[model samples]
Target: MVNHKKRRDLTTRSVLIVNFNNDLPELEKALIPLNWECASACDLKQSLRIIEQKNISVAIVIIQAGNELQVLNVVSKLQHTTPDVKWLAITTQYPIPSPYLKKKLATLFIDYYHTPIDWGLFSNSLGHLWGMSKLQIESKKEVREPTLPQELVGCSEPITNLKKDLKKVAIVDNPLLISGETGTGKGLCAQLIHAQSAREKEPFVIVNCGALPSSLIHSELFGHEKGAYTGAERQYIGRIERANNGTLFLDEIGDLPLDLQVNLLNFLDDSSIERLGGNCPIKVNCRIIFASHIDLENAVAEGAFREDLFHRLNILRIHVPSLRDYREDIEMLAQKFLARFAQDDSNLRFTNSALQAMLQYDWPGNVRELKNRVLRAIVMAEQGKITERDLGLKLTNNNMPKATPNRLRTEIDTETLLEALKRNNHNVSAASRQLNISRTTFYRLVKKCNIQW
Candidate 1:
């Protein structure tokens, strides 16, 4: 038995005891010395009600020798209802008779004690379980704090409007279609919707339709039974099934093949799917959020995409704005990225010229491109300040005279211009920024100078 004087702190800690066959007195006597409070439930149903009503970190289940099957059923339901609570089982029989019952016992209990209980050891175990449960609860709280929708990180009017739309969409369970240019944070928008939804605690599974190979796409999205195909070795759970009771984000929805689109539409309509080579239909409950950079409407009109499927997914829609449209937030975004990626050098900062260049450049790749440039600059910068040069922006004379209103007559050195173009990976927007000339002027200079690499 635990020393009564040493366990004065246990008075505030309570444990729920689910008794079968009036097995509470001995356990009560053992726990009393530790100054612990106990709540008793005669059956599993009552125990579940008690758990729902109270704050329970641990449970003690007293089981009779012959009622293992009943006990197992009750315990299984109780475990699912109060998954955070740690359960400790006590059996009167030292050796459980059946192998199946013993296996079930192992699966249900976090720890167990035999009838001729070692009171001291059991008390110690309870304390350990309580400590672990508290730690786990705190860890979960920490994880949830960072995933809030405010982390989406934009302040422009388009971003503000999008956030409002996300909040409205999150309240109702509906299939959502998110359309945006590539790298315009469509995936992030889907994540925000999931985080803000009622199913935030459940899984958030992402499927990149474009990245999956055509041959494996069907099996990958809908799963496959063992021996379903030539390479099958084991049964696999598909993304839709895995996201049951949560959210499923399908990125690059336009890239999903026409045949697979039919299956997807069926699943969306019925909330069920049939595995490859499996006859039975399995039901899944998950919110669907589809993202597409391509013009899906165009695909439908061109007969490349199904019109019916497009209409089904177009129920609720959100259009994420490109970074160019929200240029006001660039500096804020750069600072946020710098804070994340420049932890090793707290003093590092972006120079005014660097910020100016960033504002001037048309980010064709959107936020993704900005993040990449900022990350690269953090690594490549040596003077503690990130400059336009560090970000691959060149300084050119913008005041150069033009031979014609729509053309350039200034003779830009061919080798110098080619070097700048090569440095910027031949990206016209970036190359023009480096040369400090307008994109139109740069194009005309290239044509007039007849520069070719």
Candidate 2:
């Protein structure tokens, strides 16, 4: 059932050979007959440049026994930056002398070979790797729809029900209340509602009640006249005015001051707001959407939040599920985040072990935590595969098999790397800490790039 056209198209991609120490005069000649376009790089730097300039699907790194450390340091760095390339490490030592070196080799290479190479076996593996790389690229395209928001990317029961609820409420102009755990994408849910609503063309303004200073809460929500306070320099238009004829999303609504709740309730009751230091009420025709991680019912009983305001804001409600609540969507969400965060066209895949670890973890931080873990793994993963260790999640049980990890794919631009180092004062440990990666990995990357601290 193999389509000839697909097979031909797949073989058109290039293969790069990086010569670190080993010599193979017949390697390129043998590969050309097998339908591979061969490119050569004398060193790691040249190989990286070739990968950047060409459509390389696989890289063959040739090294000798004594040069493991030098070759691996540069190889790991290249793997981190060019995850799309499936690397095959070919060495002269038949039994790979050092156990430590073998371990590193297994972690970083798709496959490794010794001298007197088996041409048939190597060619087959290379073709298979190239096919997988192409499949990953196509799979990414298939999973993502240009029109849908990332928050709405899943098909789990909870997300399906949430989408239905959003559709039902989108046309309604009543104030909406969304409750969810922190990092569960409540803001994105609010945005989806706004986008689907009648006010899609108008501005959608967001205000974090908990993040704003209490002193400036009033001025931030409502407009302020010039000379309203001691430091009032000029007339200021509040977020409400900016969201006129659109939607206003108030995040962490439970954090609004008690006095401000009265003003907010009044505005909800009569679509109007009184500017600070002004006597007139301005009619604002904007739909209000409120989201909070804290339970407003509990807050009301605690005398911290007004019950009247709670009822007013709770006319329409949506509760976004936490990551642990619907474990079925974890893989989909992880893939979406990986695609979103990838800086280049690298073919990166999650190993079976990594996916198993993700499924077993409690995900206390929900979607946000999963996203951050994937982002960090992209930088720290050895070879091109992301493993459970790379994701910083330990397997819960001993029953889980530790499969060969796949390369963690993402190409973080050099500028981001330099800036991270700069922010941490050229200290490798501090720089890696800032990027949430280990000092050892960051140090290798720093050394490979010859970046001056």
Candidate 3:
């Protein structure tokens, strides 16, 4: 092993080229904005030494298929050793023994070029490599053990206090388990903790544990060796490695498979995971923050999830309030979504009746549905204004069971729409138009109302 430790201080676009000949002159003409340095020695060992000494961000390999096995061996080592390093391969001839090798190299390397490489394309490739490097560096800087200010929005008591809790938790680098109802802004709360924590400078990596499959969840979370499993096409570092010194958010953590729960539990306690096939543990220095709509306490009690894992993750907790609990904030949040969708695009306005009707409505889907409905109404409403009928709720005969009427009006949404329509006139279009609903839906309301348009 050659020692280039002294040269690690240099900041340049170091290119480690493993070629038979020292082709310094040919590589000189290609213009890639950053400082360029190259090593043309075919010995990968020597090239790696130069890379370490020079802090090379990119490597261009020049190889030919003299023997089938040699080519595969060379490519394999390059892929593993230079996992994060971008690679550009230059082959002197075409139709190299196997087309599979070519395809494999294309997938693994940044770019591949045939004999007589185009200088323009080569430069452009290097340019893209350089831009990605910049983004990675910048992104990593934002998330590494950062101390971010509070990022949670909303001034309601729940939101205001949630920010305070997030701030307190941000200082501690431990597991934070957040529990909330669906659509209660748990994701935003997790983001706020990442933004405020010491790891704020590194990166915020979110993994939906429920979305991962039983077969893939292990590899996806812990990564795998090249031949670890059948579809192990390539060795890839998992998200935990990507957030090396930042925050790793495991969303819907209650849904993590039972086996994975064990792995995650150990990882949380020890900050380590062995890649699927590899024996060596990869040390990850990241804060663990998890969120779930379901109560993990209940999951543990039901024996569907691990009790120890839940205990490990619940070091800090933040409970996000459902939209119904913050009923006073409905109109405020609705108007925010309305303005967001209608910005410089549509001429949709909410009539006082429509606004009052919205304030009285029950948004089961929370902020997300409210946003979608507002955007939909803006696109579908032919009239300039949104009325009670446009809202699609009838205002008469409050038959639906009320969920805490102090915050919401006791009447059903359909009844509210009907009352708004009746007040406007039997005109279905006018009623639906005022309701901020589509014309077709308005026609349906006409039939439902037994009123002639």
Candidate 4:
């Protein structure tokens, strides 16, 4: 367990670090407000004890590529034992080559610093994560346990807003139309929005509009009466009725035939449906959530999707931003996936360089591609840290990340400081209050950074 200094010695600004690699100078340099300095964990058991005892809000890890399994174990423990603690990885730049390390690291760890830690960006991401932790505490009433919303992870501004949007749409009963590129997690977003809604308690029925054959479309959606047609064995419940008082998720809604679209449009407009060969109109009290990889407007122009149906579902539209657009979340999301399902669940971790490589790619498949690489690393890697090699990603011949460097650069310190200041509303005194430091000390540091008064 970490040794606790007096309340005065370790204030609200205290941050706990878990590093198997001993680098006192780097660790100390990372600390702000010496009194609220970082705490070290000697071992996994010791780390858990320290985190539990100190109420450590953030953890920084300098993971060894070889001991990937041990690192994963420590990370897993941190996630559960200190559910609220912010985690950061300070490591060598990517090309890490271990599958065990890749999968485990991707699951929960957020943010990373390449060799010669980019102090500015590192500080910012850390502060952002810290701000999120504070928000989790202060807005406990508004906060719900995060459940991997839209496959977008991290506390970046864009993802945070998307999360808010998901929550807002979850409460209403309006039809939600989620539009995103293929494999960008439209179905997942639909499920998330549904889970957050009033209809979450009821059955969540999923229908792959494109996959359902034409002959069975009507019966599958509205069910059929006993002996309704040649193969009708008995009365069957349709996807619409089955999802009564719940959510009906229509995946790939663009592929639904025109006639079936009319039927679906009728149900959406009137909440009533009649089964094939059945006389009674069954009333359904449910919400419809739909996903489309293609542009509905273009489809409508081609006389494919019904314009009316599109308008109805578009009432609460949410367009999930591709991972490439909000690039800050790449490493964080990669780490989250790595940690959740790695083979060497305990010892596997990602090398910093590997994360840098991950951040460089323009994810055409978005989260899905990221997931595939991490999964591949988990199954194929042999080293402790999973690297770009393990992820099977190669840099362009020109030796640069696929995208421009600016997008890959994350401002760490400013982000963290701003988040802290925002949480405390630029009040140095209030910020100092949490760090258990004197206001004068806080001002001196703020002055050092030339931060506005």
Q: Which candidate is the best by TM-score?
A: 2
> How well is each residue in 1-453 modelled by candidate 2, as lDDT tens digits?
236644654447679998765478788888888878888887665776566555567888877767778778777767765666788988888787888888988899888888898888889999889889878754542222233454586888998999999988899999999998666888778888988999988878888776566888899899799999888999888888878998998887887889999999899988999889888999999989999877789889989899999988889999998777778899999988777765453677789989999988766457877987887677566667888987888877765333212221112224445876665445454455444334444554555455665
List all candidate RMSDs to the true structure. Answer: 22.6, 18.3, 21.7, 23.1
Evaluate model 3: give its lDDT.
Answer: 0.66
lDDT of 2: 0.77
Worst 10 residues of 2 by lDDT: 404-413
Model 3 ranges with Cα > 4 A deviation: 1-153, 345-347, 396-401, 404-453
* TM-score, model 1 to reference: 0.57
CA lDDT scores, all candidates in order: 0.77, 0.77, 0.66, 0.70
Better of 2 and 3 by lDDT: 2
Order of quality (lDDT): 1, 2, 4, 3
Positional deviation of residue 36's Cα in model 1 after best superposition, in angstroms: 63
Q: What is the lDDT of residue 114 in candidate 3?
A: 74
State in Å the error of residue 125, model 1: 40
Error of 3 at 106 (Å): 33
| Tens digits of lDDT, candidate 3, 93-153 | 6765577776767676777777676777786787688668657744643343243343444
